[model samples]
Target chain A: MERLMKIDRRLLYLISVALVAVTIFMPLGLPVKVSPLAVQTYDAIQNLPDNSVVLIAPMYDPGAAGELNPMLKAMLYQCMERGYKIILGNTNWTLGVAIAHDMITPIAAEFNYVYGTDYIEFGSKPGGSVWMQSAQTDLAGAAIVDFNNDPIGQFPLIQAVPRLTQEYIAAVLVLDCGTPGAVEWLQIITQGTSIKLIVGEIQMSVPDSMTYVQSGQYNGMIAGSRGGAEYEQLVGRPGAALKSQDTMSVIALMVALFIVLGNIGYVTRKR
Target chain B: MMWLLAQEQAPVPTLGIFSAGSVIDFAIVLGLGVIIWVMVARARTGRKIPEIKKIAGLEAVDEAIGRATEMGRPVVFIPGILSVDNPQTLAAFGMVSHIARQCARYDTRFLALNCDPLPYAVIEEITRQAYLEEGRPDAFNPDDIRFLSAEQFAFTGAVIGIFERERPAANIMIGAFYAEAMMLAETGSFQGMIQIGGTAMTAQLPFFVAACDYSLIGEEIYAASAYLSKEPVMYGTVVAQDWLKIVLALIIVVGAVLATVSPDSTVLRDILGGY
Candidate 1:
């Protein structure tokens, strides 16, 4: 029992990895309980005014891609289904726009969405939140060119949405994992504006993002991967996230079991 | 629908007196300043101020250092992975100063590791100053105050390597941390180090609390310098912050009640959003 408290960390890591691998092959088929927050997030995006222009910012790097990719896909599917004109991009996360671009192109094609008129991708920009500040006034000036390096002023969507304001964009959907993310979006473009801010946050960041949700800074939030799965279900697109629920459940139970074992050992040893 | 026709970057709407969003922030800052000033005045006049609750993480600093000294092992301080511009990293300077002075007095090895070069440069001078103040400038080793890497994972790897090699008895980490918090804290735990962790980053706080023996949460790290130095003037400021927090809490409660009673009303939101 005392040895349980001193379980070598390498062994613990090995067991966790092995468990994850086993679940990948033979799924546990656990039911994922959808939280109220996920429902709120779905409704927030779903209930937007017909043909509303939405800006989606993938505010993360490759490191967070595994968790956030499904979220971005589900969001695009929902938007495209609603026939909303989409503006895809971000600032500071250089690699993020490319990832989002790949995900959006296929989804847009499936929806028969036309480029330049129906959607435009402004690849990543520099200057973090200051870029967002510039975007509020002049969209074309802030984003000089489209993701293809062509002049954005030619696009009808760009012409319709001259600035990032409530008058133009109805909502800003942000998939965030760190600084200069959804928080920056709220502070810069949305804050008191009628433009609603909705966020998809990583699991680690849900606690911090929930504050904004409660304060009505973020109109709604998808809490994490579980939230992503719930959102995918709501969007009627059961992608990779919904399929990976079994693995997550098994990993969660493994962690809990280890905690109980360690605590029992400590308690017994102390006595 | 207000058409934002002004194509160029429009200045924040100044309804003549002040900009729209600045109203609440301006009022809060002014009120906080006046209150803090009064508290400082009271302290100077030898009047009583409410004592801040003791923080276990900070109190254990000396014990951790003493343990390191007895074991003849190094005491490693990580000021987090962020630059000095972050307020949390600035807060870490105070702890580093105190810890460095203690290490100097006891002639124990002190190693300060940083992910960002700016904090690394700043912490070097801070450690040197601590040693100088303690009349042991000769004991300070500039080489130990190292800038490992700027990349997040790279820095985590380098720090983990240091732990394996140095075998530090005490590991004190305080500042703005991200995902790297867990890896660093867990490694320290594995080495049987007396660990003290702190950060204002709520996301990273759980990792620190889970892995570190002692953890300082949010505002506690901000109030650390005041707690360590025991200066009356600093105590006054901390108490004033508490007073202001109480006032804010009341406002939130009142706002919630008003919002619930009149769901359609934007009265509170408009006033707070503006003047």
Candidate 2:
């Protein structure tokens, strides 16, 4: 009985794993409130004129896919629904190209969006920010190959679309999951360009990103999963962001409860 | 309209409340359940876990305070410019609570530079609670915890000014940071203060690593709460997180193997692919 009374960590682990799996699969819905940032980002996209060129720079990989993918999906849906031309590219390695190809392509196809006219994947650029800045100068000259590594000129989409330097590119949204990221956009390229900057940062980067938003440097910004959920709400499509909130709430509750219980346990045992 | 917005399709019968219901939701709820179960089991067993290794960044709170005490300078604790709603900032709040207590212990003056209005008020309460917890409630200084501008670089500039006028012996930065990370860290480094920093920001982790003496990398920032409390519940969460990593590793290994061998297998493809 005493040994049974003794905590079996393995059992605890089992219970947690089981519970988490159950919650993830189950329908215990969490409440969602759209944040101001998400709304602004959504409104910006929703309000854009049809067939406007929207550039999406998928900056992070699978590690941050958990946050960026939902945001991208939501944004892509918004763009496709509104007929926004999306030019998707990345500076990261194959990880990013794979993410863009696997995640964004299918969704675009579902929306019945045509390649070249509606969207083009520039694949992975040669250099990070240098290529980004240079692309602003000469779109075709800079990107010689498509995401598939085919010649850019071969694709009518690349050949037909006017130079990115001329500012036909509507809004530039950098889904930044890392450093030398949004800052580069804010600091370097977008300084005098007509291109509006929308930064989608993970939760940890909010403090600094919020600063830019408050300062009015960024036209729109999305903060982590919560912001992503709120943006989905603003777009009138409750997707994974909204669904992830249940997880967030549960995790928050667990942490808060543990804090309280741990204190109680500490005092009691010491006494 | 609100009902329309919250409605769930296909899988679940429940009307969406916050739009937070999904498989991830189940995982989260389950993760919490496990933590609670472990804590209960630990409490029942009466097995006391050993103290975790002191986080140098946290331990330096007292050392920073002591330096401030000796130098007759105030200790500046920037609880990050983020609001209380942010988990990273919330962790910073937890650290603030401890720092405030240590400041009280050393009789050293402390100032909390904040950018977000909401978190500023919370930091004030955190300061008061820290004093109260240390049995020096009267020693709590409200003037020390001040709200800077909500703007990012503007907040960085505010901290810079505070450093100039007050000439703090130590600058401790914890929580969510972005571009201004370098601005603040560089300023403190220039002032030659014993700067300790930590953030879950993997990208900015490099900057902090290059600049600060002791920097908390990815998971360590989240582990701050557990490390500080040293409570069985918090410790249990760390254990759970470890277990999760192991599971994730296994999944990755299995996934890599299957994907490598079969390449075109439906099961492996489905695992890699998502809804």
Q: Against the true structure, whose TM-score is highest? A: 1
Using Cα atoms, each model's DockQ against the true complex is 0.25, 0.02
lDDT of each: 0.88, 0.73
Error of 1 at A101 (Å): 2.3
Residue range B1-275, candidate 1, lDDT tens digits? 22222223444666667745777788889999998898888877888777777776677899999999999999999998877778889889867888999999999999999899999999999999999999998998999999999888999999999999989999999898998999999999989999999999988898889889999999898798668766566767888999999987987888899879988777877777642
Per-residue lDDT of model 2, residues A212-253, tens digit only: 888677888888999988887876778887888877777667
What is candidate 2's CAPRI-style docking category based on DockQ? incorrect
Chain A fold similarity by TM-score, each prediction: 0.97, 0.85
lDDT of candidate 2 at residue A183, scale 0 to 100: 75
The alpha-carbon deviation from the true structure for residue A66 of candidate 2, after best TM-score superposition, in angstroms, is 29
RMSD of each: 3.5, 22.2
lDDT of 2 at A173: 80
